[model samples]
Target: MGIFDVRKIDCHAHVLDPLRFPYAQGAAYRPSGQEIGTTDQFVEVLQCYGTEHVLLVQPNSGYGPDNSCMLDAIRRYPGIFKGVAIASLDADLSHLRDLRDQGIVGIALNPTFYGNDFYADSPALMEKLAELDMFVQIQVQHDQLLMFKPWIERIAVRVLIDHCGRPTPEQGLAQPGFSALLDLAETGRVHVKLSGYAKFAKTPYPFRDTLPFVRALVEAFGLDHCMWASDWPYLRAADRQDYGPLLKLLDTLFPDPADRDILLWQTPKRLFGFGA
Candidate 1:
């Protein structure tokens, strides 16, 4: 089967419908024009690509601690969507449980937005996530992963690192943060997203610079622990990145259908409990 024809899931994407859900009062960066990806538009993208399901990740760009938009989409599309919400640092246990009950499988902690110190209390939040069986999704760049390493080491929460830890491509895989990300795989509690090449790739298109790291991540984390994602709507994209090319990249990275099966379907379903 063709790559697009193959069964798959969009492991990372967002829903930004300002018409229905207005941006939060104090939202730092409001997505506009091409950046806006409404729930209906996203559903169409999935349909066009023959994607089976998707994980609706709440970007830190808008809609503060409120997850009404994502939660509402989950309710509207049960069995086909899962959410990774953004909760405040002091999110109480009950509130978390409520989110989980309503189809939120995890929470997003974006260091790119607040920097490392923003996650100072992450360890405690991680403990709660562990108890509730939710993944702690982290987005960091360069040496930022190192800031949370000590905390991650102390906690046993299931970790989902975004954008292959958003590594520095020129630095190679041995860079401290990316290296630490590779090391986390050994703990058997961490998973990394094999997407977001545009976020760090020095070049465009095929993103050749990121292939070596992708190889390293697949080798270290194995196929089951590494899943595919498309930072869809190509938000804040440096160049003209799109959804099709993102999936096509997998063909170059993984020639075998079986391996794609694991990365595109099984791994995400296993980790996020999609369709459950």
Candidate 2:
């Protein structure tokens, strides 16, 4: 069977359906009519690419902490989906425990939209997450990575940096921010998602310009610490990007079958607790 035929899990994707689960009043942005805005539509797209499992991230479009849509999808799909939710910084332990029971394995922190202080102020909540053995998924601009170093050092929960830390080609690998991310990986508790290449890619398609940074991450973190993802629906490039090409890029980048297997299957299976 081809690599694409393997039971791969997309470690990051968003599910949005404004019709049934309307966007929050204070949402950051609303999904356009053209976007794939429902769980069934999102699943159909994943099916077209041969993906069976997905990690559904609560979209910023639902600005508030309500994750009804994401939780419902996990309930509907059972083993086929897991989720990362966005909760209020002041959310009590009871709310968190309830989220855990609902199959949420992680909490997402996006400093870019919510401001850096949200995460900095939530150490207690972070501790609760660690106690629950849940992961903390962070999305921050590259330059802001250094500011987050202290949190990384103190938090005991597993950290999953989104979009390869969203570094730019102009910053290169040695920049202090990107360098800080590399340093975090050495701690062994941190994992990096090989998603959103299109966000940082200075070139088209295969996004070769971003390869060096990816190679550096794999080197620093090793195969076990790396995981593959498709930021599906491609959001900005919904009409342009297809899921198949992203999977094909992995085959090209990690030519060794063993290494490719880790990126495509093994690492995500372990990190996301797939089949566990």
Highest lDDT against the true fold, candidate: 1
Q: Model 1 over residues 92-155: C-alpha lDDT tens digits? A: 8999999999888888999988898878888888999999989999999999999888777788
Which pairs clash inside model 1?
none
- Judging by TM-score against the true structure, name the best candidate: 1
Model 2 lDDT vs. the true structure? Answer: 0.82
Question: What shift in Å separates residue 212 of candidate 1 from its native position after superposition?
Answer: 0.8
Off by over 4 Å in 1: none
User: Model 1: C-alpha RMSD to truth?
Assistant: 1.0
Error of 2 at 113 (Å): 2.0
lDDT of candidate 1 vs native? 0.88
How would you encode candidate 2's per-residue C-alpha lDDT over 1-276 as one tens digit per residue? 576777778988887777778878866677765655578887787777778788888877553577988888999987789999998777777888888888888888888667777677767777888888888888877687787777778878888899888887887889887899999876789999988888878788888888999999999999899888888666656247777888888877888888877877788888878788
